[model samples]
Target chain A: MSPTPTTATPSDVTPARTGGGRTGGLRLTALHTRAQLLETVRVPIAVIGTVVFPTLTMLFFVVPQPFADDPAQATAATAQISLFAVMSVCLFTYGVGVAEDRALPWDSYLRTLPVGAGPRLAGRLLNGLAFALVSLVPLVVVAWLLTAAALPADRLVLTAGALAVAALPMLGLGLWIGYGMSTKAALAVAQVLLLPLAFGGGLFLPPQMFPGWLDAVSTWLPTRAGRDLVVSATTGADLPGTTWPVLAAWALLTAVLAVRAYRRDEGRRFR
Target chain B: MSAPLVRLAGATRRYGDVTALDGVTLDVPAGQLLGLLGPNGAGKSTLLQLVSGLRRPTSGVVELFGRPPWEPAARAGLGMTPQETGLPPTLRVREVVDVVAGHFPDPVPTAEVLERFGLGDLARRQTGGLSGGQKRRLAVALAFVGRPRLALLDEPTTGLDVDARHDLWDAVRAYHRDGGTVVLTSHYLEEVEALAERVVVVDRGRVLVDGSLEEVRSAVPARRVRVRAAALPDLGADRALVDGDRHELWTSDADALVRRLVGSGAPFADLEVASASLEEAFLAVTAAADDRSGSRSATGVPGTSTPTTSTPEVAR
Candidate 1:
């Protein structure tokens, strides 16, 4: 039998490629990203990790605590919410993302395609960033509109801006944990890391409410810096000048370690 | 003649202290269907991975059309269906093909690929829902979507039934007919015997035999000959596994001692010959090579050959 011929649909056929460029590589990266999106939508467990758990926490915070009579309630509340956002974006997203990556043969298969390492890395970063941003919306709005008061508009903008900048380092650091640790270890660490970082970073309470030493340490924590940036954003409180620098350093260090760890892990897993 | 599509020149890949592929070399030219047959840990998958550029060789080089194997341009003319199922389960059959097709500069239409593989109805079905044989066929279809110059297939027929296996064999034959080179690795001796014109037998990270199947068969001196005789005549020194009454005796060798049987006036009648099966020859060749390497332990690791020969494990 003669083989059946197939006609090209207009949408299916793009302009014929005449040049030898990195276009195929780019397309592979795009397909990977598309796959990531489809998986996020199709897998309910993924939805919970990315959206539901964080949203529930947002709702929890927006509800006023029973002990509103406490003298330092406002400062404590702001600190608590900041901690929640940071952990949600950094540890939760990154940790779960890593576990998800481990479950699939994405890294191995992608490495084989026309996709260069750079594009694959870029696609992942974009996905993580997108997920982090989506995670912020519910919590950010709930914390702002639902709460009686928040950092003033100008401070809120600055603090949000600062938090965004701070998030870059946390993202990189989270990648280090995700890439370096096995899936089981990552989950355990994420669980252990989540509670302390949240409580210590003062997402549920203000760091100032703690003793001087505790407060001093919290200042160095990424969550602490994120909280301070948020507090400064809303209340116009003066954050330490070193806050940005510290976050920047953390980001740089983590990025380097993360790249090394990911490359090493990929090399071993593929072999 | 066109240049060889894929070449492995002294290819070696090491995993820490262990060598996965040890100075292995082969050429897969156009219109050639080459099968890499070996027991488990024989470096068949490693060779396919090297050809696909999914992994690089530790020392020697793997080239496609004179370029390094990993180059996108080099891989453009190559198709690979890995030993493990690489297709995403949740994606529909069409979607899986489309995803792979997107990687190529010029990909065949998804519908055409689906129809060619008899997967037109399954196009809308998720890959996870397809049966194993269906999945394997889809994988083959996806590999052929770009009309690749060469194909690297690892255990391509792991779960197919007899009919499906024969259908896939036809597909492979058709692929070779289209001037494509195929490097297939399978545990199934019959699959390799039927599909491959050339066989490359590997054991313990080394190539034991690389030539036409007939030549590999001839390497081991074993062929079954059936003859009718009223009385048995064993004149020569060759060992014989004979059965049946004096009216007939079956010998594994016909050329050497069977002549003596007729010379002795034995009632040698109704003579028939059975060629030594490729499977038996493969095992014998592998056994001899292992013994030469002193790998009697059958752990399938090179340079660690033991003194007491162990049976070679079948490739999974």
Candidate 2:
């Protein structure tokens, strides 16, 4: 039997058109962020790994040290560990997460949507922020309980803002690796890049104690720039003259690389 | 009249050296249900992707609602489920449906979509824990949540069992009943037969036939003649196959062939003549096109390589 031809009545089936604009884009971003966060939280190990590792490093290494006895050194150590937390969130959330997502068919579906990339990128940024903040809690608790770490209320707020700002470069770097490489390659690259960045940035040692040559190079690294900005904000220490510029340069470079990687992936897969 | 829901004019897509879609033209009017039938590597998926705006044509024009499909606005009324889709493992089925629904300005209720797809019970289950068939169902369900004017489904029921496939077909039928247009590709000819008002048979990146189901079924106008005879008759058949004492001949005019045999005084014990089925017609159409193109390219068709001879399978 032939199918009955039914005319499309506007009231019956016309879809509501949310024109792709700033407001719709923002709404989509919020929805994406909520969904992404729920997915991340369901995997307890992912959150635990990012949160526990940095806190444990501080508890086992920094709290027992004699320098942690001094309020200034303790505050600086806390700031460094917090920076480490932010870095962990950036690398794990965007690097490994994005790479794994790229391997899934859901990623292809999302990429083809009319809402464009704003929602996905913003959602990822929001997720990174959530993980970064969550990772800091344990470190803050450890610092408060076992060490002489102290920060004025206003400085605490400033330190939080500075750490977030500093994380931009790391997030961009993560995106570059995620979009440009396979999941396995991205995972290995993230691990390989993480430790060297942390060590060279003086997250494990004071910049003042670094040899002259190492100190000069460290001043130019984004991680070191981030470390100086956060430590100075919390402990009132002097920052290198190039700290802000170094961070800005790294952020700009990685952002460009990330965008290029995204376009390249899009062209190769969808074109 | 409004513009066609989808229009492709001489659209072609090439991947490296292989052309996935050759110069071809097609138009799907609103509210029409089209089934794209083809063998493996026949470019059905490629054609669907072009309509979905997931890929651009290397040359020629592709439009949705009369606008260039590359524009996001052109794709606003389009929904598609590709050949493969992996749902987020950690998200519950309900959550996945809801999240996808949220993208539309006004979407079908999540519960209603799940219920329609027989996924109500699995709503609370994590997508990763669900069976492959369940995942496939969910993926197809998500495509309808937005109430799109046009839907492109590529092998939507590949992993579904008989019942599941029927249930999915009911959902598609209801959608078409409501005046929704759809273009679906599938390996199951029965699936196409069940849902498609219009059928397009594609092979080797080109369309071999396009018509209504009945038109396509009779497209070849050929019949198969089977008989048991002690001696093989010298009949002019396009093709013939022999199995023991039974002989089968394929010809466009079965009546004439039979009369000729009877006149020739061939002693035939049993004889039967039957019109070609949709399956046979499909094979004949593709095979005839392949033979024509293969011979043409053998002489000289620039950039054309020798066509590989592989028997078409229903499941592929």
Candidate 3:
């Protein structure tokens, strides 16, 4: 015969206390982020596919160009590529990742827990952020080592802030796509949206090169708004007056859609 | 009745035309190892889903710790293992345990939890690498990591070997001994017999019997009756089938069944009867109930056809 102890005793478990909400939520978020990151990183393609292309594009196209020696052009190019890196990482991570998680029964189990979706959402955001930062490293390093890009430490700091702000819409859009679509659909949408956003935003080619119609239409896109704000910050160029409002509007729209999609996604599936 | 830890007052859930849970009212006090015993599609999963807040009842009240089960706060003391849940394939078992344990205020050490569930050796393996039985055990173990007041397991030892099932039963028993309440659902009468002090048999979206294990056993009969008769009348056996002049019946009261058989003047012979081991009786009881209800009650769903009054199907 053996005497074994259970983790909880009846007397101690009388709705006495829930995990301290503020601290416990934060801790749960951290753990979720850690778990998501571990799972994602183990599949190298998930991280590598997002990080490699931006750095490769910079090395092959921008760094070899004559504009490689122009500080303004070089700095602007660096910022654009950096934005692409953030966009890709955020979109694929959330769009593909969230859809993948949604397809899992584990997700249903997690949703059933007393902890709401807050921690999981926060954790996923953090996971996307980590990869986004990682994807930026190679492109930024190429810009610094091979190009005539020059900026003060503060300017670099400003680029980071602009990049973070620029990442907001992509994050929301990624989340929206992730929660709203199945994995195959999300992967296709994330891929389909990537190049158009990059080209229209003048990330690969400057807006001055755009046709009259595209230049007019391009400015309305979130990617264009992000590029304008980031390019202005990096090159000391004048930011269009409409940039902030446009980006903010898209951010608001997509964030709301993402949240709503997530809340309803499980209900619709289980129903 | 110290205000039962879980209270479902006439909880009913309907999916389209299928009434998955039909007016089920039950109270579970703390520390009770209550088994929801039923056949497939007997609404066991739906009942657990209602209590776990995965799905709300279409009608009636479902409460955990006095609050509606749908509220996230009300789930604070509850843990659940759905019948077939996935483990994130790439993470090592230890990491998964630690991450889930992080959700609790006071968590069991990951290593200890692993050891208790015989998963210590598997701590470093990716969960995707685990065999089905191991994955099942790990899933069951995670429920205890949070030290929850209530654990809802929908067929926890489903894929395990008999040895594995026994090991898991001990772990569950230990948890119950320490005052953790368990509400497990299984189609297996044997499984229910092994772990539950209280048992509730559900069929066709209704609770057919609910009582302490001994009380249920004494009330339900598991006797098998075999007799050759030229003709047979309605003896009211829980289950009856005749094959080419040979009669087979499982009766709760074999003595009365015999008297009824002879008094009917059917000219029967070759009498034989046997009793004990509860599955036959349990199946008979549910089977008889199934017959009383319309055969369509087997699956209230609008489509799909399964044989009605199927004891074998129910046992499956």
Candidate 4:
């Protein structure tokens, strides 16, 4: 109250009315990402929970095993756990994150601002992806140090591409859970869903050991499809014709469910 | 002054069968510092939500700045603080302000906003570390960060201590003096008396009174007379409240009530009279409406005849 109006120079802050165009929208999206990521990483426990488990899995389970020196098996094992890292980050980040944000009055206030939901939504997705990428670093470094998880540069790039593309379904599922449930429900759902997708989809164990029936079921799971897609890229194994289409199908279906859940949440909360 | 900044025509909002806002029509001309007065569940917050375009009306028109309230362009000049809000717990106070400011085309520098809200020192602290009063101030401060033409503040000072409340009032006044429009709702009558150029009283999702402060006060002309009395005669007042050694009575004719006390030879002293508190005035009007319609939907959910007793039970 002691301070009166002190209009800083026109250049002092973001110019008003600039949010109408594509550039301004991009800027706002980046701003949202920065703010959300800061809010997230400031809580050290959250970062550790999302980022550490995958690295630890690779360390205790993969690095010290016989597959650690076999180039093909080691590459395949590294690819599988990388998928684990991405899946863990996405599930908790979106599933738990969205539900928690909805309960925040800050979230509602942000919605009331002139910018529509596009920037904030895009920012959250980007923020999650950013963390997923970061979570992969320690695992990759450890795989390089302790395992013969060697791939030609081109194959490594291809494997990265495959993993990135395959992440869509998991991202969609996370969003679906986040928008559809309360925080407590989302946390339970994420936890319950993660292990089955890992073990059944063969992220925890290789599919070579699966009996025919489990293999049949695993092939149809999005996680298994994702695992095959990335593992083949890294190992140069025969690619299945159904891999891309299966991931695409899961992605499309979950995206629709997520959007519907979001609309329903809005109706119940404020409408 | 060119046109009403906001106009609501029979606007209604219903959560399934329970209508939060009834068919209410009102116009807020530019530059009016409006105070919305009501008890719990009176639709004051709902009305602000409609005007701010956070929720759509079920049946009627709600316009802001001559356009649909939901339009982005229409919201450019608007700032709002809902009755309940949350700040991201882990975010530093300045970062939260900056994030909200980023949405506006032109915003006051984050520093200036924090300073004006008396939050300059707390800028680096995470919002989770703030006390209730500090949090409320920051919440209110976000509304003015954009230098909005219209500020809709819902219970901005609800949790503040008197000095903090006064600080917020000063921030609001400075904005209004610069020709900004403000619409705020408060249970504190002194707040309305201090800030509102025009006042609107709402009850049962309907507007009971909409006029200058003077007109609303006159319409419900009950004066509060405070006396220290024991074993008083039956000098009936409109309503009376007792606080141990003090008896506070509301009556339009303070002179007559005092005279009657003397004539009856009731042992009373330390008599004082002022305008009836808005709480007293509001209950009298709502109670009168209750009696006219003979409806139990007045102050207390389960109807009772005692207006003074019923109001305090609901107001807090």
Number of the top TM-score candidate:
4
lDDT of 2 by residue, B193-296 (tens): 79999988777777767889876654443588899987776787655656777887767678888898899898886899987644464565445446663311
**TM-scores across all candidates?**
0.79, 0.84, 0.84, 0.86
Per-prediction DockQ scores?
A: 0.20, 0.33, 0.37, 0.34
Model 1, chain B: what is the TM-score?
Answer: 0.75
Rounded to one decimal, what is candidate 4's iRMSD? 6.3
A54-131 in candidate 2: lDDT tens per residue?
999898769889999999999999899889888977887898888888777677676555566677888998988888
Tell me the spans in candidate 4 whose CA falls farther than 4 Å from its real position: A1-23, A267-271, B82-85, B221-256, B264-281, B291-316
- Report the lDDT tens digits of candidate 1 across residue range B180-229: 67888877767877888888877667776777877654454445455655
Docking class of 1: incorrect
Docking class of 3: acceptable
lDDT of 2: 0.78
For residues A128-243, what per-residue lDDT tens digits would candidate 3 score against the true structure?
88888888888888899999987768787887899899889999999999999988899999989999999898888778879999999998999999998999888889999889
DockQ of 1: 0.20
lDDT of 3 at B58: 88
TM-score of chain A of 4: 0.89
